[model samples]
Target: MIKGFILIFLLGASATYCIAQHNKAKSAAIIVTGKVLSQADSNLVKELFFDGLHEKIVNNFQRASTNFNKVLEIDPANDAAMYELANIYHTQNQEADAERLIRMAVTVQPENNWYWLLLADIYKQTQNMAQLVPVFDELIRLSPANEDNYFDKANALLMQNKVNEATAVYNSIEKLYGSSEDLSNARQRILIQQGKPGKAAAELEKLVISNPSDLGNYLSLSEIYAKSGKRDQAIAVLQKAALADPANALVRLSLADHYRALNKPDDAFIELKVAFADPNLNIDDKVRIILSFFPQFADYKARAYADELASITAKTHPDDPKAFSVYGDVLYQEQKYSEAKEEYKKALVLNDQVYQIWEQVLRIDITESKFKDAITDGEAALAIFPNQAPLYLFSSIAYAQSGNHEKAIAYLKNAADLETENKDVISQIFSGMGDSYNALKRYSESDQAYEKALAADPDNSYTLNNYAYYLSLRGENLEKAAKMSKRSIELDPGNSSSEDTYAWILFRLKKYADALIWIEKAMISGKVVNAVQLEHYGDILFFLGNKEQALLQWTKARQAGSASEKLNQKINEKKYIE
Candidate 1:
């Protein structure tokens, strides 16, 4: 009996093994051809699918597509193979083929999340908003708890101008995840886009009540109110936000804006001061606020506020070069040039790569008459930006101011060479060259450069005055010099320098009577008479045969510093010694 039981057990075990093998073969067949496949064919299809994936990864798209096609030929229902082929087509911008293949893949394996996502992306890429809606709907159905899928559906609906439907989707998200500021804001935007700002404001109000501690909600509501012209309502919302989050700098800024709009200048300034005092406010925003005060700079109160705000920016953002740079701009505009130069230098020490800052620093140095510093800084700037004509021009000015006429001419030539189609810059360069050459006693070159400068800018008063003065000093071209000097005076009436040049040119022509009148005008036109003007007046008076009065003027010229050596000789000799 034991032998018989053993044989029966063996037979039942063999039958169970056969049935399991048969079911496995049937599953493989469904995967391949929806019919039974031989074990060899199933293995080959699997091999091809993996090889296609490897080829795709290696960017061998043609080979990848070939292998995928072979796998699909062997197993027509292979959704993964279809998806891979669709990806290759998508990459090639064959969207129609991609769409057809991906749709087939989704249809074959409707529950494949990746397949649905690819289809949705394809719809989005094609801008087929209408088609994208159902794909996102399917995605939502597939992944019911996925919040991103709901957002995608809402966006698709919004693209179709289906505001109500989009709002419903956003509402669905809130239901799934509880109330959120993002959802509320999204709904608000949709309502606002639909021209129902009242509804939008209502939506944001709901968020504010739900999350009273969140200042962002209040700010959003205030913006909407402001945009809708409810100025008082906007101010009230911002005030509530500030009370809720007293430390928020952005809220304070918004409050300042609203207060200003309400025409309450004191309230506006108070809020602005609070906002600017906050260390948490970003440097860029502070810079913007400071810039807004530019138009109001003529008002003492506005100027003081701007100055205080700039100081705060410097303190809060000590390492930020922009902070100091912007402050320097404010001071420079106010004509506090020396202080502006210090600020720009501080900014450069922090960060020297900004070209605009370099420009500002050099400009301020020139304005403050820091000639040595300007030359040092301008040369460094030129090294970094050799092609910049403005840098060359600035460097030339620095060299000229420092009495390096040869170097000045070289730098000015470089500026003229680099400047194209900018007649103003070219004119300035030639004018500078004229000055440098004249200083070096290269009178012919100086005269040529001056002519070119006048050709470029006929109304250049500075050039006219300097050119006429140089010609008069040389005792050549007196008539032309007199005409240019007169034109310079006409262009810049009451300019002491032009008046002095005309008077000197008149003296050179031996018109002593005419020279006396202009020399006197030059001395009185300026707030202070310089040693040069006093000496010139002495010479004109002596030429007109007033020895005693001329001697008196010479003594005064000596009292003023910078009187020429000849003035001392003439004073000692008790006569004109020209």
Candidate 2:
């Protein structure tokens, strides 16, 4: 093996000597070698070289060492070959061999920053920070004017937990480069990490002020302020940035978010209005923001914006139904249902293929308990998009609400069959079927449907709570119902409906004290608390011999919307104190 190696090296050395002696002859030799290298045949010299490299790379260290040595014999000063040989030694856990080869490569190419960088990388990989520092220092010295060298050196210092060194290097780069955004950003990050947020904010603010066209500076300043927990200052900065560039839609949107965070809904809406008018913002996003704030603004502003949206839709997207659909959404959020319905109809007329508008109309009908109308709209939507599972789900719900359980189950089953991989969708469909069966007093069928729902989504809080409540109402499966109720509460402690179900299940089992605790928890969980839950709480208190508190709770339930005969009977039977 050693004799073969010596022969190969001698052949290449002889070629070099011949080239030095006869330049014209060397040029001809180079052309011949180029021709051989350019050939498509695998038998070519370059192809063999690449094949050997590939064979080395595919094997472990033993094969790689031999192949890389052979490559070095063919081309004595190949830095890439030396680097690969070093990598092979390193991967084989031969640290001494790797370091020796890498150091020799760097010494041979003293001007090559890449060789220095590779040495630094090897030191970093081995966690030799002391060795890495000197090597990187040499690299930066050789490439002093290159920004990447400075940046990489700074990053390496930062990784070594040398914050002051990193900061100083970043500052040096920034001073020399004159406000390069990357160096400026690096300085700010280091300052913030060093707990000098004030200095960071000041630098960023100046950067933003000087470079007003660079909105990223303003955004970074806002982030820095927000990270420092100075939200009011952040918002104020964004507001100024918006005023500085009113025509910038992104700045206006950012300003609107700031206003929204400050609870200044009217101010946010005004900014959003200007942003939406720019034609730069995505129409869908603009419309969504407009609708979201429409409900919060005064009625006149909502009406005016709704009119503006309609005008924009008519002028810009005359052929598109999505604009009209957005107009409908804004109107609907403002409780202008009749106008919203007309807009939806107009959208549908413009493009009957848009199933979402049909679904939107169906949702409105469902909200108003217009089950027949909901069913009609849902069916119309399904006609356009037969495989749309949400449309099928809505159709089943509307049919069930209208007392057609058979058709409801059929639609729900169709949805379930189509979305077998989507567990949440299947669970929801089966839950809808269970609700329909329960409404029709088919207890056995309801039980089966509920079981199907649980099987699909074992931890679904909504399905667990509703199905458990139904079980309690039927006076069977009390223990299973109690367990399910507890599970629902554990999954979503803040869900008022789930809490109510748990409390009611406890009441059914005559655990009155435990029932009252959970009932009160449900009542307090919501700001606009459910009336039915309050009445249930009152009933639990009444059973616990707290007549006065029970009456008070029952009265509050009446105010919220429970006008049941049972509640009225309790109020009449219980005497009040003057």
TM-score of each: 0.76, 0.47
* TM-score: model 1 vs. ground truth: 0.76
Give model 2's clash tally: 0
Q: Who wins the TM-score comparison?
A: 1
Mark the regions of model 2 whose C-alpha exceeds 4 Å error after superposition.
1-145, 174-176, 179-181, 204-243, 257-262, 282-358, 364-384, 388-578
User: Judged by lDDT, which candidate is best?
Assistant: 1
Candidate 2 C-alpha lDDT tens digits along 1-578: 11211111111111232234442231122111111121343233344356557877678556656766765655555556677788777777777777666665654455666667767767777777655665666676677777887787788788788998987888788788876778778888788888999999888878887788788888788878878888788877777777777677877777777777777867776776677667656777756655664554576765675667555654566566777778887778678787788788988998888766777887788777888888888877887888988788888888888789889989998898788788888899999989888988998999899999999999998889889999988879999999998999899888888888889889989899999888878878867777888788788887898889989988998998888787787788873221
Which pairs, if any, clash in model 1? Answer: none
Question: What lDDT, from 0 to 1, does candidate 1 have?
Answer: 0.84
Q: How do the residues 16-112 of candidate 1 rate in per-residue lDDT, one tens digit apiece?
A: 2323433322221112223345688899999999999999999999999999999888777677998999999998989998977776676566677
